[model samples]
Target: MRGGPAFEVLFNINTYLKKKGLRDKFELTFFAPMEKPGQKMGDKALLMMDKMFKSMDIHKQVGSKIVAFESDGIVFENGRKILSDLTMFISAGTGHTILSSSDLPLSEAGFVVTNEYNEVEGFEGIYAIGDSASLMGAKWRAKQGHVAEVMAKNVAYGIAMHIQNIDSKRSYMGQLNILCMMDTGNGAAFVYRSEKGGKMIPLPIIGHWMKKAWGVYCKYSKLGKIPRIPGM
Candidate 1:
């Protein structure tokens, strides 16, 4: 796990392993090409992660890119090799190759370029949302499901306003925030980060159930079997 929301998921796994007394049985190592991973969450969250890593005896490899993966290990660009029985690597996001052949303006990463309102710069009445559209905001900004939903709503509103000849438009920028429920097998944590700061609230047992409930709600609501709660 490098950084962003995935870091919390790794932390949740760590918590589960430790609780089950299986942490020492398997080696856990987090690798990232960046020197300071998780810095996007701010200084306080970084400090907390450092403390957790030290307490859990988790190994971290940073500032080294992986050149190749062998049957039994991984080779780093610096000629260092880390041998492991198993490896789980998370890759950074890249736009679909189809975008490269399209007329849409794209970033170096191939993400379609868009304005604050998710409107394509040169494509009239065409908007790109979700991971397909490049996000513009703080350096820490990331593509997320909630953000995508907001963009969809904004695009719908934009279309209605266009038909009505209204000047008002909605923006997804003001709603940007990191809100996630990080769950371990036995417990969970409420993680929230915004312009103000970041906070992680440990919820011993009920938090796990809360996440499960949210998953059920999402599935049913999407199928149109259950009405979606406003702003859920």
Candidate 2:
């Protein structure tokens, strides 16, 4: 998912299917290009996740190149074949297909070129924020709303200073962080990371309600029915 890790997305889908009494009817396996995907979430999170997946009977195929997707399943470069009834794919990061035809400079992933302040090079008064901008950070880095929100605020400040003839600018570096509220159907986990490292705190029933409340707030705030809570 755009907001969550591929493992979490696929696992949740499996959870949903299980709720319909279909757990024994399918073989669910999670695949990713990264060997240890979700490392950004923290080592503790990954350790916990592995045990959780095993308990749920989910298979994992990661850090392996997919040779091909045959009619029955997947073929790996190492001659490993996993029979899968269906396959779902999501890139780590990608851009619109239309961007490939545009004149704007693009990264290897097809995201737009931009400076730390989200300003497009060779084009004054132009900016690329959110998923549009080529991200800069650790291999564990991800493009989440926190990063996008910081870019948005910084771009606004940078443009305002430009108009005032002030030689000032703000960089999104150091401000962006990894944050996620993961729901496991029953409860949830609060995941966060920064220069100080990362943490994943498991929350019980209350966590589920908290996430639901946030969902409602997100929906209404986007629709102008309510104001966004600060630093959300």
Estimate the TM-score for candidate 1: 0.88
| Model 1 misplacement above 4 A | 1-22
lDDT against the true structure, each candidate: 0.81, 0.81
Number of backbone-clashing residue pairs for each candidate, in the order shown: 0, 0
Worst 10 residues of 2 by lDDT: 1-10
- Candidate 1: tens digits of C-alpha lDDT, residues 21-55: 89889877777777888776667767767776786
TM-score for all predictions? Answer: 0.88, 0.88
lDDT of 1: 0.81
lDDT leader: 1
**Worst-scoring 10-residue span by lDDT in model 1:** 1-10
